[model samples]
Target: MAHWFHRNPLKATAPVSFNYYGVAGSPAANKICNDLRTTRARLLDMFTDITCTPEVMKNATDAYFSLLQSFIVSPDGSTQDNKMRFIQNFKWTDTLQGNAPRHVAQQDMVFELVSMAFNVALWYTKFASRLAGKENITEPEAKDVHRSLKVAAGIFMNLKEMHIPRLITPAEKGRDLEPRVMDTYIIQCQAEAQEVTIARAIELKHKATLIAALAYETANFYQKADHTLNTLEPECSSKWRKYLQLKQHFYMAYAYCYHGQTLLAGDKCGEAIRSLQEAEKCYARAESLCKEYRQTKGPGSTAKPSEQLFFIKLGGLIKNTLEKCQRENGFIYFHKVPAEPPTLELKASYGLAEPVPFELPSLSEQCTPEVYATFDLTRGAKNDKAKPKEEEVKPVKEPDLKPQKDTGCSIS
Candidate 1:
């Protein structure tokens, strides 16, 4: 199962000191700053250790975001001005922005919100991958994998729709928070979550037609995700796009193979034969792409997708089903094989994955009104202490996001 999913390394970040600028130092304010530093460090450290459970992550994230809310959004929904935003500097490196530790920094708290949320989303993906890679996954573990992916998708979508718009400086192209990368994360998480559902359905002895439809829709999700990165440089995006491409073709093969079985049950031997033929071709193409993916130079940990049981099962199913269809057609019906393959089932009526809704926790108790009132409101003065110079970010070559509509599946 380790080979079932491809994962990029987590984005690196610089530590924050939370030094207050032009403010009278008080216990509450100092406590708040110390809490911010402690909670943020805890949250960031979780990424380095994937074995941390979701409950631990939630508590750490909640503690950090609760304190962070005072800097950006208040408990009562009041918008803070530039004076509050420019008080602290936050820096983070992009995931696909090369091997060096080059980072982009901003004197804006909203930027901090976006970068931290992005990391949290990535942690969910890593958590899901860790769960999925176990030698034997139980029913509860499978459900955990499914839920983690949906939560990850939700966080990415939340960053895109809510926080990204509020950033004082827009995210540059190819950065993790950019719209294209955001869409890629959202789509990929949902698609992988659906993979769990497809596995469950197969185990439950669901109809071949249902499994085929689900597989086809899952393939569409991966294709859409891959297309979002099309405008980026090949060096930055090629490996990831190849991963998506291979998964797309692999699920398509799954669709056609199960579809052939459906057709066989309905006594459409000719159509079944043609469908199985298409399945074989798609599986072969996926196999080639898997090899290319391994050789491609890029970021992220390489996965041997071709060696996974899920992949191996499809090839065996395609071979056995195709043979059965051919043997039955020759001895029983002798129906004419059509020139074109049958159209794949476009949509699955049920079990499609949807992102869960997410919102930051409320302002922490340490950020009281007295502490909020003590901060200086003027932006004319800058922090005299030296800080990391902001890196020059390249303009994005990405298009506007065009997210696919979900089937309104219940994530509960």
Candidate 2:
């Protein structure tokens, strides 16, 4: 643990000690001093446990030396002053003056330190693995770990900044305040955070199918709204139609891309390439339609900023899919074929004079007898006109027939 701390000095500080400057004899001062002592004790205990391992000792020593060097080169006060100056220059007086709340800042600092430690550990681990002749971790695996850490950090940061009690108001002694009290900002932020958390969780769990389904549902809802607006307001039909088309295409493309990625994972390169190509085409069409819609709206028209962001996101997805395909040596070519005109052929008998003029039948008269008899039977008859003689028929003998009697019941 000390080795870890030494490698990352930021991690050495207790969470509560961040920005805990206290006046003498103040409660804050006491709290900070106690926290510092506890942190030191924990580090000392961890250091003692690794005393038998020389390699661990050397790592710890290096970490300590690096941290000491950092302190000697640039002290904490100097770093704080620089940060203060930067924030002040940006007119972030509230943050500088401690009015932004210590917990939020501390949480952010803690997350930053943890992030740094993770990266350092990752580098060290990779080096060690290489020396040990172990299989190397893949880029995607590394990315997944990093993403998980970041998401965890985000959750912690949110927890630190959240003020549940403050956001809720007590009802008056005789009246209900639930209807009147509302923290719209907090509610919106929480809702968005939940969405992000759920999405990230799904990704981490490898429930990509679920994620795709959710995305499809969201897109469909938006498309339905667009359709509803168009139906209710005919004058804005064109705008809504474009909006609906863009959303439908974007979602469908996103779904295709997700499925393509799954195929790529399964080593179906050809199928993946085709799916990704189709997805790219869909996204490109969506972007073009969005641009056209914006242009049609004219200058000074207040268009939603999200429309442009959607295009940007879709473009990024397309580029990523293409890059992935290229990296895997999976590429496909689409060719355009030109249409050829129909050819007509005519056949004539050599013995016959140039075919007699024939009238084309009208649609109603197409199946008439005149059309059916166009090929005269007499023309193909044999050239000989001799008559044949008929033969006389002889009578044949017939056998005699006998009748039989049937018995009947008297009761009938």
lDDT of each prediction vs. the true structure? Answer: 0.82, 0.33
Q: Candidate 1: minimum summed lDDT over ten consecutive residues — where?
A: 401-410
- For residues 321-371, what per-residue lDDT tens digits would candidate 1 score against the true structure? 999999999999799998999998467999999998888987788777778
lDDT of 1: 0.82
Indicate the worst ten consecutive residues by lDDT in candidate 2. Answer: 1-10
**Local error of candidate 1 at residue 386 (angstroms):** 6.9
Question: Candidate 1 versus the native: TM-score?
Answer: 0.91
Q: Which regions of candidate 2 fall more than 4 Å away from where they truly are?
A: 1-206, 297-301, 304-311, 326-412
Estimate TM-scores for all models. Answer: 0.91, 0.29
Candidate 1 has which clashing residue pairs, if any? Answer: none
Write model 2 residue lDDT over 1-412, tens digit each, in one string: 0000001011122222222122212453334334433543343233324122324533443433332222112232243311111110000001011112111122232222222232223233222212212123333433333333333233223322432122223222211111111121112122222223323434354454454454455345445545443433233235434555565666656656666666667766556666677778777877776676555431112233233333356567767885776667534433221132111111211111111121111212122223222323234323224322322211111112121121110011
lDDT of 2: 0.33
